[model samples]
Target: MQEKFVINIGRQIGSGGRTVGELIARRLGVKLYDKELINLAAEESGLSPEIFEKADEKESKGLFPTLMGYLRAPFAGDDGGCTNVLSSEALFQIQSDVIRSVAARESCIFVGRCADYILREHPRAVSVFITADDACRIRRIRNRSGCTEEQARATMARIDAKRAAYYNYFSSRTWGVASTYHLCLNSSVLGEEGSADLILEFAARKLNTKF
Candidate 1:
């Protein structure tokens, strides 16, 4: 078995998934990759981090991203314009590379960005999806964003649609479906810490490791 392992987390916006992933990583003494993938992809691709971030998670609707970003980007050519633009698809590819590279280097927890699919063939990778009931989600969102219940519901719908679209576009599997992941958890049922403990127990058994 491979010494390095990865736990890929798919989370709803207010599900406390990222927080739980952090807890797991801390327990295992491993890094967590989330928005940090943008910086890593930027470094590897020699493009501005802003460019990669704009194309993040969403599927490419066209052949190229707008040149507006390159106008202020340091990498713009001598004519003060972009020499090339990477579509959302291209950026996804680069980010996927960064994901694989990091996971190979050491064990880590990855939050969102379809990491479960990206590392599907890894010898010791575990895939998990997290969800929460509307009440729990509304409370979490209100506390975090100061949004009212209706507004929080709106935000959740908007973001979840985008995430499902992105995941479906890039992978063969469906998002948030039980069959799509090795395990699934309801953050509301167990709360964040309890949910995390259950995940640890499940993953440790699958990975044959102690936590």
Candidate 2:
């Protein structure tokens, strides 16, 4: 019997993480789940796509004070505020459930969204953290988003901050710290294609261990 493997990728923004994940999925003949998870969560929660988009892999920083109106405290609020909280929580539940469903369905590559924590019990799962040099990441961001280096750097920091906050809020493990992942790779070291090949080779060997 051929044993299945799950690859959960945690990556920095503009670090070629998604590109490598897609290539790894293609080479391994597995499904790739990233943005598609958002759609699935929205459908499951019966929420508007915009709500999910706003809450996607993000931490709720609490509601606005002025928006709460006469509502005194955070807990004391109108139906709209309550509804917003409920919808956001519902979306998160759906996302977590969908992630579990995909892991159970088959071997697949999951990019981000605390997938490593989601599949921690899976026997053949490999958790990886992808990052690159600041220069490389800034350049990539600039090219992709047409922003200046300073803007790109700020954007990168902002997005990564959100991701870190979300992950930390949801999971006990820390993000980007060496102890959190089984393996950490710098995409700039080998380029995107080369990094993909290296990861494939490593995963293949790990998968073959039971053979």
Candidate 3:
């Protein structure tokens, strides 16, 4: 029998979280959404994809001026100068709408953007967090990005800080904490394929259905 469910994955940078998501999606014959979500949100909102890309999983920096402009204008000027600015809140709402719509349509894997919290009400949704030790993450980052160890560490710190800030600001729960997820796995300990397999096993058990 085929089972329908949604999987939300929250991952640390260089943890191979996206790779695990892709593997699970393929095994379950479901769509995997990560960067694709930005395009989907852009299409649905009639906004440029670049706008969504810029705001993806990052807090709105230097947006206060634009937000204030929109609040003040409320409508176009006599010269047809549009004062509509896409705030971080607006972008998040649009993406959340897209995420809900897609989840309602079918079972799929959502790689990030706080999908777990967004779909908290879904009965069949399972949320997982993927992380790795600092050394392993640094190594993976260096290899994939062709950076020195110091550069990899810096990159990881910067990206993780952005992700943490985004998640903490938008969601009620704290980011990367074990209590916030149904299951948290260390990709470095298990390896990418092994991590995917474990997630499948856990899902099978939790959902009480075979994959």
Candidate 4:
């Protein structure tokens, strides 16, 4: 109980992974690291946050956009040089450092951005994966995004592909696989509240903590 522990969550798009992570953090009275990580990584790297956000959960696609973005950065050199070249890989390393630094500092829940793999060697790291069936995921996405069924499906595919590509590129383990995580929950079956409760219980048991 002296040392702090961290919960790292990986979820499929529309699986309510973010919601579950928030719930766990609230119940544990700890901070949740999600989009907030982008801000931290931006500060850590001394680059614009927009570049990190744009590269979030994606692989390097091309050079032109990144190059153009560099010229637009306020800190960019007057010579229009790429002193701080930004790419998906570069952004990932920055985020990974932020993840490790924050995890070491406090007990928190990290949703996505490959936090599980980033903190793989942490003594008290708990990793989880949330997944749902196609119908369930599509329904959640439609409800949250107010998009048509086709649009929801498309969004799911796009986001899932990007997340998988990002995780697989940076992690030795594949994303969403049961063996890769300490616990894998079907959010569709458990629902958001139930999923959070189950994960909390799993973490308590895994870490031998009295939560």
Candidate 5:
């Protein structure tokens, strides 16, 4: 067997999660995969990249409430006699196949796309979730994307909503709910390098690998 560890990251947007994931991958000398998974999925599934991008990290249902997300199932029945909506099995299959292909090829760090859930069966796997305070996340998004604070906040809301629904729909676990991951780190507290160092140290202890 190839003796290597796989680190899968599920993170909130603007949490400096991607930067931390990249840093950990570099520290561990492992390949980092994020948006590349989209390309890989597209190629594997013969689906256009645009289609996958639209569905990526989003629930099949557009029904998540705009308020505090109490999701009243008001329109739950007889919408074209459809009973099962929000099904993501097709997307899940694509992600699962792509993740397995990557894992078979080499050990690496995979960020988002429910990679932890996709690769749940792998033996040498560590799953992490990263998040930050609303204010911190909004600031980071505004700075990175050059959006106004309101725009940043709105974008965060939409993206996080989609991610939550998609993750919950597929994984049978709540997103960022603390119980779904082996490590849950607040990037606001640790910052980028500090969070990276914490993950590196944890990995070192678990895998007996040197930084």
Candidate 6:
């Protein structure tokens, strides 16, 4: 398709959502932004990338308290006030700007970090939610993370909770809800490649273009 469009994927932990996103981007010949977004946001905000990495997809303890801290001083005071004190909300805002900038410039696939919500008003954006059965997710997580089944399950719960909390805190929509996304797919049923193919077809149909 000559007309550029953005794909925003929201996925549960260990559901092969990233794999599907990478495959779709490869098939469409566009850049995929996941961890790359942190670098872009860090560059734009002039804050240490490590901070963004640590705060990625995590909700702040309390927005009011964090804003009060920011108001108290321009930077977050820690270790004699040398570090930048950007709250989770500040980091999200910076990343949202980067997402908007990228979408404005070209076609790309954005995985998580609420890209769907950030680009809600974009004329040619496709939002997808990728999920899988818990058993499937646990097995996938165990294989990828080299952890036991119990550890995998724990990891999944922890990460998904953080993502849900972050998404709910920042956006008006709820995370992993099918209605919040234009399309929802079960990655385990279709597998990564199949899911990517489906997304490409869906995107083409949504944009009324041939892929």
Name the lDDT of candidate 6. 0.88
lDDT per residue for candidate 4 within 68-91, as digits (tens), equals 544257565667654456666667
Error of 5 at 123 (Å): 1.4
For model 1, residues 1-211, the per-residue Cα lDDT tens digits are 3489999999998999999999898888889999999899999988879887777766566636555553346466668654667667767888899999998889899998989999999999999999999898889999999988999999999889888888888886799999999999999999988988999999999999887
Model 2: weakest 10-residue lDDT segment is 63-72
Model 2: number of backbone collisions:
0
What's the lDDT for residue 1 in model 5? 44
lDDT by residue for model 2 over 84-195, one digit each (tens)? Answer: 3343444566688989888887889999998998789888898989999999999899999899989998999999998998788778679899799888999999999998
Model 6 C-alpha lDDT per residue in residues 32-151, reported as the tens digit of each score:
999999999889876678878988888776632353444356455565444446677777888999999999999999999999999999999999999999998998888887899889
Residue range 1-211, candidate 5, lDDT tens digits:
4486788888999999999989988877789998888889878865556656767888866532233111234344445343322224565677679988998779899998888887888877888899999999999998888999999989998999989998898888899987888889999998999999898788667666665
What ranking of all candidate models by lDDT puts the best one first?
Answer: 3, 6, 1, 4, 2, 5
**Which residue pairs does candidate 3 place in steric collision?**
none
Alpha carbon deviation, residue 208, candidate 1 (Å): 1.4
Candidate 5 global TM-score = 0.83
lDDT of each: 0.87, 0.81, 0.88, 0.85, 0.80, 0.88
lDDT of 3: 0.88
lDDT of prediction 2: 0.81
Better structure of 4 and 6 per lDDT: 6
What are the RMSD figures for all models against the true structure?
3.2, 5.0, 2.6, 3.0, 8.0, 2.7
Q: What TM-score, computed on C-alpha atoms, does each candidate reach?
A: 0.91, 0.85, 0.91, 0.90, 0.83, 0.91
> lDDT of candidate 4 vs native?
0.85
